[model samples]
Target: MTASRPHELVEDPEYFRDVLNSMRMIADKNLRRVRFGLTGDGIAPHYEITVPDGDYMEHSVRFPINGLTHHTHHQSPEPFEVTNLTEKFSWDDVIGMLERALSRKRERK
Candidate 1:
């Protein structure tokens, strides 16, 4: 038998677009008046969403797509909550987590 090769992952822009669109649909269904966009390219793309707090101040969070699902505030390493999607996460899980994050009302001090 011939030596087996490791499976290489290819960067598919179309697939990425589809994922982005799906995320947008979820956001539209759950959240209101939020702006969504993409940040970065290739394999390290992130989903950026700007949500308005109680004071109407826009707060943006970036969610990386490569590993465990988590959202960061202003590029901080401290994520709101870490959920390992590699275990048993699904699109429903994503919607729940994202809705929680987006719906959180930030206090204005």
Candidate 2:
């Protein structure tokens, strides 16, 4: 490759190693595996990724610890409601989730 690009564009192998180390630390602190993946539809434009629709825990977290409060006891936030994939379909709720997350109004129930 030519050197015309910025130095940051030339990522070193150490970048991945460092990212792995950071992820290890995060997993250790949170006690959970950090998962990341594509919603699929975004890549296919209008198309949706289908999976079984069922009830899922759809876990989330909240931070109660504060630096100023330091040693104070931490409290967990209220659990929010969500549904899981139970039956497979050609559609995905990712777009819907993205919409809701972005504060866009839902089209229908």
On lDDT, the leading prediction is: 1
Instruction: Write down the TM-score for model 1.
Output: 0.25
User: Considering only N, C-alpha and C atoms within 3 Å, which residue pairs clash in candidate 2?
Assistant: 52-85, 52-86, 52-87, 53-85, 53-86, 53-87, 54-84, 54-85, 54-86
Candidate 2 residue lDDT tens string, 1-109: 2222121231233322222333333233333222211222222111111122233224433222111222112432321112211121111222233334334223331
Q: Which stretches of candidate 1 lie over 4 Å from their true place?
A: 1-11, 29-41, 52-62, 67-109
lDDT of 1 by residue, 39-82 (tens): 22223233333333444446644343331132333454442232
Q: What is the C-alpha RMSD of each candidate to the true structure, in Å?
A: 16.8, 18.3
Residue 26 error, candidate 1, Å: 4.6
Count of clashes in candidate 1 = 0
True lDDT of residue 80, candidate 2:
14
Worst 10 residues of 1 by lDDT: 1-10
Query: What is each predicted model's overall lDDT from 0 to 1?
Result: 0.33, 0.24
Clashing pairs in 1: none
Q: How many steric clashes does model 2 contain? A: 9
